[model samples]
Target chain A: MNVLIVLAHPERKSFNGGLVDVAVKQLEDAGHQVEVGDLYAEQFDPVEHAEQYPHSAVASDYFYPLNEQRAHYQQDTLPQDVQRELARLEWADLVIFQFPLWWHAQPAILKGWFDRVLVYGGRYTSRMRYDHGYFRGKRAMLSVTAGSPGIAFQPFGRAGDMVAWLWPMHASLYYVGFDVLPPQVSYGVQGGGIEYQKEDALRIHLNACKECWATRLAHWEREKPIPFAGWEDWNSEGVLCETSPWRWRLG
Target chain B: MNVLIVLAHPERKSFNGGLVDVAVKQLEDAGHQVEVGDLYAEQFDPVEHAEQYPHSAVASDYFYPLNEQRAHYQQDTLPQDVQRELARLEWADLVIFQFPLWWHAQPAILKGWFDRVLVYGGRYTSRMRYDHGYFRGKRAMLSVTAGSPGIAFQPFGRAGDMVAWLWPMHASLYYVGFDVLPPQVSYGVQGGGIEYQKEDALRIHLNACKECWATRLAHWEREKPIPFAGWEDWNSEGVLCETSPWRWRLG
Candidate 1:
C-alpha cells in the first residue's frame, strides 16, 4: 500500500511532530510505502492563488464549480512545495492529515492546502457539471491534538467532541470522494510533562493510524462498504446521512 | 450609529452587490454614518503576517494562549488594506458581513478576515477578563445569498436549513463577544429571473437591514431590542438555529 502523510505544524519537537513520526513508522512496519509531506518544514504555502494553476500547463483548464474562485485556479503560480504536495496526494492510497487543532479547526496553512490543491475539476465540481461539482471516492483520516481536556468537548461541556467539531472538514473531504474515517485526538495536550506527552501521543497516533490502515485494507478487498456506526445508513448515493448535535444529544 | 459594511464579493453586478448597496442605503437613511470596506474591491489580503503587529505597535503580546503562533503571525506584513479594514472595524458601532454563500459557508476571503483580523490580543482575548478584546459592544450581522431555490433549503429537503448550518459562525462570533443578530440569508438567489421573487428578496433584505440598524440604535439608547417575527427568532443567539436542506443534499 502507498500512504501519504500531510503534516502541518511549525514545531518538529511538538506532539504533533511525534504523531507524524509514529504514523510513518507504523505504516512502514506494516509493509506500506509511506511518504510524508512535512508541510511546515517544506514551507508549503497554504494560500491558493492565481499562480497555482498555470495556463501554460495543459491540465490548467480544470474548473472548480463555484464562480467566485475561478480566478484563483487560473491566475497565480502555485508555490513549488504546494505543487509537490499535490503530486503526493495524487499518488497516495491513503491520505493522513496530522495537525493540532487551532481555533477548533485546521490551522491556516492546512486550510490553505484545501483552498488550493483541491481544485474544482480535480477534487470538486467541474465545467462538465456547471451546477454540481464534487469529490467522489478516496480515503482520508485526521490526527489531531487539542489543548483542552477530552471531557470539555461534550455537548454539555465547553466545546463539543473533536469529531463533531470537525464536521466541516469531514463533510468537505467526504463530499468530494474521500471516505472520511473517524479521527485520532490527543486531549490534555497542554500539560503532563511536554516530553512524555509527546511520546505517548505519538504511540497513540501510531496505533490509530495502523488501525485505520487495517480497516481500509480490509474494505479494499471486501465486497461490502466499510460501515460507519455513528451515522445513519448511507444515502442512495452511498454517502453517510447528515446528522448534528441535537440528534446526538437526543439519542 | 456608525455602521461598517465589509463586502466580500468581487463582482459589482452580482446580487450580493445589490444587497450591499441596499444595506448601505438603508443604514444611511436611518441617519447612521456608514463605511464600506468592499474587501475584494479594496484588495484586502486576509493572510496574517509579522508586519501586522510590530512589537512597538501591538497592544497585546499574545497570539495564542500558549504563544506558539507569534512567528507565523508576524511572517508576512499585514496587508495595508486589511489593516485599514481592521481600523474601520474598530471605529464602527456595528459590522455587517455581506457575501454570497460558498459551499454552505463563508467565502474564503471572509473566512480569511476571521483568520487575520480577529488577532489574539487585538480583536480577541483581551487581558481584562470582562472587557476582553476590541469590538466588544460592536454588533455583527451576516448577509448571505444562496443560489438554490428557497424551498430546497427547508428542513425536509436534502440539506437541512441555513440556520443550523450557521451555528459555528454564530458560536465563534459570540465567543468573541459580538452581540450577534440572526443572519439574513436570501434563499433562492438563483431565482432572480422571477420579477416578484427578486423584488420580494430585495424587500426582505432592505427591511431587515433597516430593522437591524433600528435594533442596534435602540439597544444603544437603552431601549428594547429590535424584533422581527421568524427573522430575529430564527436563530435565537443572533444566528439562525434552523437547518437547511442545501447543507445536507449533494445537489
Candidate 2:
C-alpha cells in the first residue's frame, strides 16, 4: 500500500516533526510506500482559490457535478505549495496528518491545506453521486501531540474526551468517503514530563502507525460506526429523555 | 459598538455574500459600527513563519505558554493586513463571521485568520491574569449556509447535528475567552424551486441576529454553558430517564 504523511508544523525540530519522521520510517518498514507532504516546509498555501476547480470535465462517476454552485468555490488564492500537496493527496492510499494541536485543533497550514486542496469538486463533492463522494475508501489518521494530559479528553473532565474532540474530523472524513482510523494521540506534549521520562513515545507512536498499517485491510473490514451522544438523538426526534448526560428535559 | 465583518467567500454574489450584507445592515441599524475584513479581496496570510514570533518574548512564552502561542507580535515581519485585523479586533466591540459552510465548517481562510491572528498573548493568555486574557468578553457569532437540510444533522441520522458540528469552533472560542452566541445556520441553501421560502428562512435568521444584537448586552451579562450529549452516561454509568427534548437526566 502507498501512504502519504502530511506534516504541518514549521519547526522541524518540534516533536510533531519527529512524529512524522518515525511514522514514515515505520510505514516503510512495514513495506508500504510512503509519500511526505511537509506542508510548511513546502510552503503550502492553506488559502483556497478558484482555478483549482476541474470544471471542464463533467465525468459522471468519479467527479462531482458542482457547476451550478461554482461560486462558493471561490476564495483567496492559494500559494503554489498547497497545489503541490493536493497533487500528492491524489497519489496516496492512506493520508496521515501529523501536527501539534494548535488551539485544540490543527495548525493553520494544515487547515489551510484542507481548505485549498479539498475544493468543491475535489475532496468534498464531485460529479459522482452525492452519497458516493470524494475520498471514498481512502484512509486518514491524525497523529497529534497535545499539551494537556490525555485524561482531559474523557467524559466529566475539564476539556473533553479526545475522541469527542476529534468527532467532527472523524465524521467529516466518514461523510466525505474516507475509511477513517482511530487517532494516535500523544498527550502532555508541553511540559508533560513525558518528553524526558519517555524518550520512546515517538517509537511507540510509530509502532501504532505500524499496527495501523498492518491492520489496514482488516480494520476496514471491521469498520466501527462512529459513536454519538444522546443530544444528537434528542435533537433529531425531539425526544426528551431524563437521566441522560447528553440531553436535557426542557420544561 | 464597532464591529468587523471578515468576508471570506470569493464570490461577491454568493449567498454567503448576501448574508454578510444582511449582517452589516442589521448591526448598523442597531447603531453599531461595522468594518469588513474582506479577506478574499485583501488576501490575508493565515500561515505564521518563525520570523513572525515576537522578538523580546521569552522562549518559555513562545514555546510553552499556551496564551502566547498564536500572536505574531514581531513588528518587522508582521504583515500589514494582520496588523489591520488585530487593530480592528482591538477597535471593535463585536466580530461576526459570514461564510458558506465548507465541508461542515468555516472556510480555510477564516479558520486560518483565527490561527494566525488569534495569538497566545492576543486571544488566549496575555500579560494579564489567566482569566483576563485577550478576547475576554469579546462576543462572536458564526452565520453559515449549508447545502444540506437541517434534518441531516441528526444523532441517529447519517450526519452530525448543526450545533454539534460547530463544537470545535465554539470550544476554541470559549477556550480563548470569547463568548460565542448560538450559530445562525441556514440549512438547504441549495434546496431548489422556492425563492419565497428562501426569503422567509432568511427573514427568520435575520430576526435572530436582530434579537442577538438587541440583547447583546444582556446576553453578555449571563454565562451560557454549552450542553453536551449523554452517550457516555449510558456507556460509563447507566441510562437515565427521559424529560424534555433539550433536558437530560444525570445518574
Candidate 3:
C-alpha cells in the first residue's frame, strides 16, 4: 500500500514526529511504500488568501475563495504546494495525518490543508461528495497526540470528548469520499506528561505509545472504515427521512 | 459594553465581513464600544512555532510548546501580536468571533488565533480552566457563516449537524473559561448563494440575515451563555461523576 503520512506538528523531534517515524518503520518493514510530508519543514502556509491565486480567474475586486478555487483548478493555475499535496493524496491508498491536538482539532497547518488542497470543484462538487466522493477508494486516518490522558477525553471528561472534537474532520474526509479510519490517539504526550509525574514513567509511557502505534499500523489495512450515512438516508431537503435506518446512530 | 469582533475571512467584501459591519453598527448605535480585529488584514500568522518565542524561555534543542508558552508568559516576553490579542480579550466584555466556517470549523487564521493567542500556561492552567478560567467573566460567541442551508445542517442532515461542527470550538472556548454563547449562524452565505435560487432572492435573503443579526445584537445582552459542566461536576480523575446532574447533557 502507498502510504502518505502528513505531519502537521511544528517540531520534527516532537512525540507526534516520533509516531510518524514508527509508522514509517512499521509500514516499510512490511514492504509498503511510505512518504512523510512535513508541513512545518516544507513551510506550508496555513492561511488561504487572494495572494494564493496570482492569476485571478474571477473579478479581482472581490475575492471569492470557492469561485477562485473552481476557476484556478479549471485553468490549472493552482498554487504549486497545493498541487503537490494533491499529487501525494492521489498516490496514497491510505493517508495518515500525524499531529498534536492543538485547540481541540488539527493544527492550523493541517486544517488549511483541507481548506486549500481539497479544491472546490476538483476534489468535491455538488454531487461528488459523501459516499459518492472523488477519492472513494482511498482511506484516511488521524493519528493524534494530546497532553491530557485518555481518561480526560471520556464522554463526560473535563477536557471534553475527543471523538466529538474529531467529528467535523471525520465528516469532511467522508465528504471527500475517503473511508476514514478511527483515530489513533496517543494520550498524555507533552513536555512533562500530565498523567506521569516521574521522568522514568513518562519515558516508559512514550515507548509504549510507539509500540502501540507500530502494532496498529501493522494491521491498518484490515481495519473497517467508520460508518457514515449516505445519500439514500437523507430526504430531498438534505435531512434524514423518518424511515432512514441510520437515524438512531445520527450525530 | 466593550465588544471585540475578531474576523478571519480573507476578503473584507465577503458576506462574513458584512456581518461584522452589521455587528459593529448595532453595538456602536447602542453606545457600546466595538473593535473589529481583521485577522486577514492584520496578516495574523496562524502557525505557532519556535519563531513565535525568540527569547527562548525553554532550551532550543527540542521545542516544547507548552513549556515555552509558560516560560515566555512568566517572563512577559510573549510575541507582540499575542500580547495584543490578549489585551483585546482582556478589554472585551463580549468577544465575537466572525468567520466563515471553513472545513467544519473556523478558518486556519482563527484556528491559529486560539493556538497562539491563548497561551497555554498564561491563559489556562490545570486549576484555572473551565469555570475557573482566566477569562471567566468575559463572554465569547461565534458569528459564523456557512455555505450550506439551514436544513442541510439539521440533526441527521446530509451536510452533517452544524451544531456538531461547532462543538469542538465551543468546548475550546469553554475550556478557556469564557461563557460561550450559542453561535449566531448565518446560513447559505457564499458567493453564488447555495440556498437562494434567484439572484434577487439571494440579495433579499442576505439583507434579511443582516436585519436578523442587527435585531439579535440589539438584545444580545439578554442572551444566556451556553451551560457547560463546572469543576464541581467532575470527579477526582476529571470524568463527570455519576451523580453530577450533567450526565444527560454530556457530549
Candidate 2's error at B50, in angstroms?
2.1
CA deviation > 4 Å runs, candidate 2: A51-87, A122-134, A191-251, B51-79, B126-133, B191-251
RMSD in angstroms, candidate 2? 8.2
Give per-residue CA lDDT, model 3, range A145-180, as digits (tens): 988889999888888888888898898999999999
Model 1 spans with C-alpha error above 4 angstroms: A38-86, A126-137, A161-164, A191-251, B10-13, B41-86, B126-136, B190-251
The backbone clash count of each candidate, in order, is 34, 34, 0
* TM, every model: 0.66, 0.71, 0.97
lDDT of 3 by residue, B1-251 (tens): 99999999988877788888889998999999999999999999999899888768877666778889889999999999999999999999999999988889999989999989889889999998999988998899999998889989888778778878898899899988999989999998868432323587789889899899999999888889998889899999999899988887623
lDDT of 2 at B78: 46
Q: What level of docking quality does candidate 2 show? A: acceptable
Best by lDDT: 3
Give lDDT tens digits, candidate 1, residues B1-251: 88888887645545666676666776677788988887666656554433344442332422222332333235434445555666787788778788766545566566657766665544555232122424557677877777654554554333445654565566556556666676777765642223224467665654564455445444433432222122222232323234622223221
Candidate achieving higher DockQ, 1 or 3? 3
Error of 1 at B50 (Å): 6.4
DockQ of each: 0.12, 0.24, 0.74
Write model 2 residue lDDT over A158-241, tens digit each, in one string.
455566566656666665666677777776565322242245875465445445544553343355544333233334344333
What's the C-alpha lDDT at position A29 in model 1? 69
**lDDT digits (tens) for residues A184-236 of candidate 1:** 67765652224444477655654564455444444432233223222233244
